[model samples]
Target chain A: MLKINNLSATVDDGNKTILEALSLEVPAGEVHAIMGPNGAGKSTLSYVLTGRDGYDVTSGDVTLDGDDLLEMDPEERAAKGMFLSFQYPLEIPGVPTMTFLKTALNAQRRARGEEEMAAPEFLKKARALAKELKMKPEMLKRPLNVGFSGGEKKRMEIFQMMMLEPRFILMDETDSGLDVDALRIVADGVNKLRSPDRGMLIITHYQRLLDYIVPDRVHVLSGGKIAASGDADFAKKLEAEGYDAYAA
Target chain B: MTHMPLKLENLPTRRDEAWKWTDVRGRVSETSAGLSVAGLPKFTLPDGITVSEVETDDLDTDSAMAKLARNFGGKVWAVSVPEGFSSDTPLIIEGLNRGHIRIRIDIAKGASLSVIEHHAGDAGGFVNVDMTVTLKAEAKFDRTIVHNDPADCVRIATAHITAWNDAAVTQHALSFGGALSRIETRLAGMGKHIEATLNGAYLLDDKRHCDMTSYIDLAVPDCTIRQAVKGVVTDKSRGVFQGKFHVRRPAQHTDAEMRHDALMLSDTSEIRSKPELEIYADDVACAHGNTIGQLDESALFYMRQRGIPLAEARALLTEAFVADVFDDLDDEDLRESLLGKIREWLKEG
Candidate 1:
């Protein structure tokens, strides 16, 4: 459902190129994991796809369901069914988690000519989802991610992903800073979102996360391009070995 | 005191450091021609409070504006809360026209009260208000003053407060600037173990100007004072905040902190802040902070990425920036009302 063809991007006002003609595709009903070493443009790929500022896309194209995604604003892309679970979720002070969720949900709905959800219905759904995610109702009342622990932040990110129910999901280093228990809970949340109609791109440096939410296809990212493509066993091989051989 | 004639020209000019940013003299000279005193709205006191109109020639002629108010023959209104009485309902005082008003409030010993004074009018004139509040020993008092004047109107308000031993006083003021608006406060901690909080916010747009100036005196031992003032300026609006904390020699264990933060929503918007501490006590804690900047860009982007439009994200973040000023307020309805007003103001642009 999501395709990136020869995507070349730069950093620092084009002073440095992070992604050099990188190409990848994740079809609907498939979960693709991009494993790479440090400075291999893993995070850069997510940011570029999400249209974050300062990461200029110098060439190539990205499309979702045959619609051009690069031409839309970040929020427009969000309304077009693109979701990014930030590696370090921003602590937005003053915007309560519930309010943020409702706004996001309604914004996407409104963009698609759908009626806004009533407060009661939205709260009911949010409370249920929050419970299933093991988040306290009180946490939803606090500011988004403010004062949240590392695990809580990761869980909240997944909570948002589940609530938004986007068509394409981008997980950037979702395993980092998570303990074994938190890893399981987060993996369960992601696993529940797996469906035949949605596509996911899991970007990570380690194979520990793959053991929980195993990917259908694994791609080794080296020097901004896909160096090797394999099945689920490739992640285990990288974990036992390392990215040193792929660096060359 | 000398009976000098009150003249608009005698108002503090921009050359004076305290009035430099506000330019009150210039604004008065330009807008004082049509100034007149119109009828005032009737005030209804809440439970546990009494109001009486006192006929007295005694007036505080401390400044040119005060002298002008005295010359207008304004009646003195005294409001008092009896000793040992406490009430949850706040006294609501509304100002609806251009006039000179003098009010004195007495919170008797062991009494507690909350007062909300709202000022709004459509008259294209000026209003001068002088208020004095006395909190007796062990008394508690909270006051919030909100100004929503028309664009052509001008408001000059001054308040003097005295807190006795073990008394606690909190004052919050929010001003949506008119053509020219200023609120000056002089507060004193008269006895030991007093606590005082002074918080204010100003939202100005277009060519409006608002000035909040205060001088607080910690005269007795073991008193604490907290002051926070925030402002948002847009278009050609101007915001000024000047606060001074004085710790006397007898106030040995006094603690005071003052912070002033402003958000400039437009390049032409101006904010001038001065927080000064004058201490004669050797064992006192006093500090001040001032900052002026725009909203955080990262926070804005983060909100937008979550599907919130850019404008709405900006408004939410700006509202949050100034939300802490009202944290100490206990009235939920009033706090919501004030926040609603802030959101309305943010949506105006």
Candidate 2:
């Protein structure tokens, strides 16, 4: 479970307050969706929670499974079972996907005081996961997202989420720019990887992604903080109604 | 032997066939002839892999061939690659005169060898370092040459690799130094199947110039050659890469790929790449690519978003850009050393 308390952050240097004293928590065994209109800081909130830089933490405390997530390094946060599927992931050429996945997974394993997985074991698990996700085998050979299309990039992020088996994941608009079929495939991959001990925060701009990976709670964000919170039905109402009233 | 005179005729300079772009004739001080090699630093690798020298001018003075013997006179180094030689022992051969340093390596057919020739001296100095690698048919040679010498330094390092049937030669050259440094590599592949990869990385700063001109000759069948050169230039520094993969008619089923990618860190920095493939036969899959530009701003923004400071991000990207050249280097110790030097350079740049 992830706990966030009194989070207020600003886009560094500028007096721009992206998150104005927002606070929310996602309990274990549940999916929390954050939806908002343009410039509502939905992505900023996700970034802030993940401890991404640029957003100066005006005042905040974020904890994962009772451990302070804000104080940890990016890799350390990752080792503690936290994942973020970025809206625009990096394209690392010449560094194969398998190498990246193995490095990240091994780093986590090392942090947890576990024996490093051998190359053979790593390959076996990766191949099996790719097959379940319907990922092309050739993808594992290429550089991480080097020449991947938009849909493939999203799919690769979910694939990492599955492979790492993160205890908590922040999907920052993982559905953006994806076609319906591609979105369905990605959502299915995320759905299959979900577990009772894991929690997720799916950040999105549209209501369509909520249909596949239904959230237990839907929060409407406006001006950085949560403006409205409700059950799954709130998503349908917003889809039919739009966030015009929330902005007001 | 050519006398070590202050004014020697036909001095090798920028006008020579090998050193056309870098002229070092008017640079060397007259006091250089007396400069002692005794004070040169020595490096001891972690393992007991100590480097010893052998002289050929004592044994076969007349039998010495071409440039190796002409400048080499009687000096030759027969480096003994200890059995199961697997450490990252980078043999350093710095502080050289216009004379040559020819090292003949006997890497037992299946053995692995990583030879790193590092150059560092005064500006306007002409140094020729030649290394002959004969992989007895099945040996693996991961050779690397790092040239971080002073600007106006003219350097011609020739590496002749003969990978007899089924041998692999992963040849890497990092030329971050030199006013005009060029690495020319000539490889003969396939006594069976040789995997010859020729890669170069240069970081140009303050009008420094570099060139990696190589020729890969695939005389036999089933040989694969992959050549990639990446550079980062600042100020008015220039980077040039001219690579040619000649696949003869007898060399069938050859797979050769040559890629040149460079990043200009400053507005005045320039890069010129010509990747040529001259194939006399049709049964080969060969491709060449050249990309010259700056770092991707989006990637920079992304890394900055992750809280890695901008300077650190640039260093990391620069490292990652050139790190591919050493990805296949068989020696772990040598790889780490090269990476360390590159990281240091990135920090300052």
Candidate 3:
């Protein structure tokens, strides 16, 4: 469902190249994990895919469901079923969490020529999801991610992902700031949303997250390219050792 | 000795330190005809309130614009609230559409009142208003000014407020600019343990201009003062904010803070802000903050990435930035009305 061919990118016209001729594909009904160390361009790959600024693609072709994703703006890509769970979720002051969710949902629906959800229906679904995610309902009333704990923010991300219900999901360093318990809860939420028609890319440096939501395929990213590909066991072996050999 | 009809020479110029940024003298033509004596404003009073004309000759003031208002305006319209009078409904003051006008409002001891001054005075004419409000001991006064004028008019409205011991004073003003418009407020804390809050917001579009200037004095001990003003300037519009908090030596427990924040949306749009705190009391806590810049790009990108269009995202962020000033307003309906006006302003162009 998601394909990348010969992706070569730079840091916005800079001399340094962050992504080499890297190529990877995740088919429908599967979850893939990209494991890399610091400076391995793990986050850069997610940002480039989601059409964030400050990154220039020198030569690459990315397609989602056979549609050219690179040509679309960030919002357009979002409306086309692309979702990025940011490594560090921003604190958008004055925008209530529930209101933001409703807006995002409606905007995507509007873009896709679907009817907007009514307030009562949206509230009912949101309240149920908040309970299942173990998030306090009151947190939804506060400004989006403002004054929320690290665990709460990660949970909120999962909450948003569930609300938007995108076809392609990019989980960028989702476990960076989460504790063990929060990691379990977040992983459980992701596991419940897994389906045969959706594709998931989990980007992380450690194998701890894979223990909860195991990936179908694991790729070792080194020097901005896929150095190795193996089954989910690869993640356990790399965790025992380290990225030292891959860093070379 | 001053003449009957005030000439344009009586207006303050850019050379004057107070009107440096807002130059009425330069904007008004020198060869234009002088201003004549004008009548009082139309008032929609609540129960137990009446208006009477008092001679303006008894009023003496330093402000050049106020002096012009007193001299050209024939009399001061007076409105008094009886002792211990508290009302759930606000007293509405309207029809401040033209000419020079002066008003004096007195709140008796232990009384509470709310005043809504609606200014839609955007005719091709010039308007000058001088208003004074005095609060007796332990009185509570809430004043809200909603002003919107188009690009063809010039307006200057100034208010002088005095609060006695243990009195509570709250003022909130929202303005959409005229050709050249200014809402100036000067508040004095006259007794012990008084609390005062002065907050305002302005949204200027096109070639409209609006200036919100306030001076607060904490003259007595144990008085607390808070002031915050937020503004947004779009297209070729200009928004100005000047706020100062003065704490005297005798006001030992004085706690005052002033904040002025503005957002410039277009390349040609302009925003000028000055927030000052002058404290002579060694034991007092006084602070001031001022910022003039565009909206946060990171925040904008975040919102857009969530599927909101760029323009909608910008409007939402701008609304939130300007909506913070009215968070403490006691009247929920009035607060929502102000926010609705802000949203309407954002939706236009």
Best by DockQ: 3
DockQ for candidate 3, please give it. Answer: 0.70
**lDDT tens per residue, model 3, B82-120:** 999998888898878877888999999999989999888
- State the lDDT of candidate 1 residue by residue for B198-310, as single tens digits: 99999999988899999998879999899999999999998999999988899998989999999999999988888899999999889999999998877766777778878
lDDT-best of 1 and 3: 3
Model 3 regions lying over 4 Å from their true place: A244-248, B1-6, B30-40
Clashing residue pairs in candidate 1 (N, C-alpha, C atoms within 3 angstroms): none
TM-score of chain A of 1: 0.98
lDDT of 1 by residue, A1-72 (tens): 999999999999999999999889999989999998999999999889888889999999999999999999
- Enumerate residue pairs that collide in model 2: B14-B22, B14-B23, B57-B74, B88-B334, B109-B139, B165-B191, B165-B192, B166-B193
Per-residue CA lDDT of model 2 for B1-349, tens digit only, reads: 4444334334456566544544445344454422212112233333544555655443222211224334433455556555456655555555543445565666665666655566664555555556666787677776667778776565556666667878887767777867656677778774857887888788878978787878788888888888888888888988878788999898999988999989888898877777788999779999998998787766655444333445755776677888887787766777898889888888887
| Winner on lDDT (2 vs 3) | 3
- When summed lDDT is taken over every stretch of 10 residues in candidate 2 chain B, the lowest stretch is B33-42
Clashing pairs in 3: none
- Indicate the worst ten consecutive residues by lDDT in candidate 1 chain B: B30-39
